[model samples]
Target: MSIQSILDIGKSGITAQRLALEVTSENITNVNTPGYSRQTTIFQTSFVTEERGFPLGTGVNVAEIQRAYDDFLQTQLKTEASTTGWSSTVLASMKRAEQLFNEFTADGLGKSMQEFFAAWQDLTANPQGQPERQAVLARAQQVVDQFHRINGYLTDIKREANQSLEGITSDVNESLTRIASLNDQIKLIEIRGARANELRDQRDLLVRQLSEKVGITYLEQTDGTLNVSLSLGPPLVLGNKAAELSLEPDAANNGYYKIFATSPGDNTAVDISSIVGGPNNSQGRMGGTLQVRDSLVNGFLSDLDELASSLATEVNSLHSAGFGLNSSTGLDFFTAPTVTSGYSGIGGIQLAISKTADIAAASVDPVTGGTGNNLNSRAIASVYDKVLATSGGNMTMEAFYNALVGKVGVAVQDAQRSSDLSEGIIKQLDTLRESQSGVSLDEELANLIKYQKAYEGAAKLVNVGTEMLDTILGLIR
Candidate 1:
């Protein structure tokens, strides 16, 4: 080989080794950086020449730097992330609702119901006393107030869930736009035969974040761009462009939102609300929130309505049939709904009799062919045990409410267990992913030493080439 060729080989070795050292240094620098994938320098032999019957080897060339990536592992991570997000969200809200209905609390519904019935029993003992009559009114009002408070709190919880949906949608949109931009940048760099490792890492991190908000599927195209979409719906990002999701008010309930995804191919927005868990099962936070608002909170409110409506209906029926202190008749203890159906029981119910004397404690008055008795008062107190049709079978109001509370407790426990399981799965997947792609400082430090020695050796070869060239020049002179 010519001396000039020998010099070129040494120069190439020096450059390749230096680049390797630089990559090792970068890995060490970003060891603690989140979502930073470890990169390795790829070395390729430069062009070879056929001399006589043998090929002369050239020094190494620094090829593209490759990131440690596993597509299947990343996909699994995204799925687990979505699951964890969904379960955690549901568990948190369910726990919050459970705290409100805690039977251990003094102002709980069960306690109020008990006190209300006790007040009626007190009035049954002193049927002719005004103070006992006032106590019944106060306790009755307390019961209604408890119902209203629970209904109001549940409504507020549902509203908060809906408000969070807007933020989730906005975050999803931002991720889509950022992914599209990264796709463009990655494609540009890759087309020039370079690896955009950092960009790819950033894009993958965003994809995981997006998966937490809503389930997503992604594909890595040959052109170094990612095509992303909802797991069960339309494409969200394709090449350098991204499809947008728009929120419209639901037709059935204007307070809720119907989400639509617009595709670039057809430019038509398709309603994906159901598929995304609007009223269906979901694997992400958005689905969890919808479940809380539509199912959990709504179910509790319905039970409260049934309890209030049934209790009021039976009490008013017995009280109205009797005579009050002033010989008043046809007066309801609690206002009954005019319609048979579609009544929001707790919200619509009120005390029909404002005056304390209006309470119908007499089934008959003995003075004028009527008995002034406490028979009706005792009957009204017994309404708690009256197995109304709303109780679903022969269960009393107290038994029905107890069952409801027990059901909510069971639901909360299930949610918490699911969240814990999801977290465990996500933790395992994350550890596996980190082992594969995450930077290891110890490994990088070891690599730094090896590359440093190789760099030094390559520099010595360049020095030898310089010495050899100088010797050849001395011989020619």
Candidate 2:
């Protein structure tokens, strides 16, 4: 080979080593940057030529920069992020619901119920006493007030969930648009035979954020664009276009929302609310919110309504058959429904009688209609021990209340357990991903040393080539 070719080879080697060192430096600098993948410079030997009967070797050239990544691991992370996000959100909302019940506090419905029944028991001791009757009325009002408080709080929680759903939908739409824009940029760069590594990493980070809101699945196109979809429904992003998400008031429940996705191309809208829960639920933060509003809170309200109806019906029945101080018969102790359908549950229950003289405490009256027998009051007091209408009549009022509170506790515990498990899985997956794609300072330092040696060796080779050329020129002279 000619000395000039040897010099050219050394120059190529020096350039390649310099680029490798630069790439190593970049990796080291970005080691702590979130979503930054470690990069490695690829080297390729230049084309070889023949010198007489020997094959001559050319120096190295920087081919391409590669990022350490695993597609399978990335997909697993997205799935885990979605799950963990759902469980954490559900656990938080359930805790709020549990707080509304407040079973451990004195102001809770359970205590009010016990107080109401205890007042009735106190009335049985002195059925003729006006003070005892007044106390019973006061306790009854407290129970009704508690029911109203619980129902109102549940309504507020449902409203908050609906409002939050709107916000989440907006966030998801913004993310879809950004991801679509990134897709366009990435495709443009890749079409020119260049890697858009940084753009890809940014897009991936956005995808993980999106997964927290809703479960997602994605496929890479040949032209370096992604086709992203909600796990159970229509595509969210196609190439450079994104579908829009919206929320509308639920027809059956005014305080909740029905989610929809609209295709940007054809302007087609599809209701996706049912996908929030059921066998095909996506199981993300949005899904958890819907479940809390539609299932958990609503269930508690229904249970409260049942308890109120049963209590009102039982008291009215026992009081209706007795006589009051004025010998007034068939006077309901509490308000009775005008219709034969009984009390209209929690919201409709009211004090039927205004005067304490209207409280019926006697089963029978003397000839003068002045008897103050305490039999009816004793019977009303026994309502607490009797199995009131609760869960097909197997539980008393207090037992049913305790069961309701217990159910909430169980749900919260279950959600927390799921959230914990999901968090552990996410940590494991993240650690694995870091091991594959995260930069290592020690590895980068080693690469720096190797490239530095190569640079020095190439410089030495160039010097040798220069010396050999000088000798040749001297001989020629």
How many residue pairs clash per model? 8, 0
- Candidate 1 has its poorest 10 consecutive residues by lDDT at 338-347
List where candidate 1 sits over 4 angstroms from the true fold: 47-55, 265-267, 278-280, 338-346, 369-372
**Alpha-carbon deviation at 94 in model 1, angstroms:** 1.7
Cα error of candidate 2 at position 331, Å: 4.0
Report the C-alpha lDDT of model 2 over 16-77, residue by residue, as the tens digit. 99989988998999888888888889998898889998988787888899988888988988
Q: Over the stretch 180-254, how does candidate 1's per-residue lDDT look in tens digits?
A: 999999999989888899999999999999999898889999999999988778899999888888888776864
Best by TM-score: 1
Error of 1 at 19 (Å): 1.2
| TM-scores of all predicted structures | 0.93, 0.92
TM-score (C-alpha, index-matched) for candidate 2: 0.92
Worst 10 residues of 2 by lDDT: 338-347
RMSD of each predicted structure: 2.3, 2.7
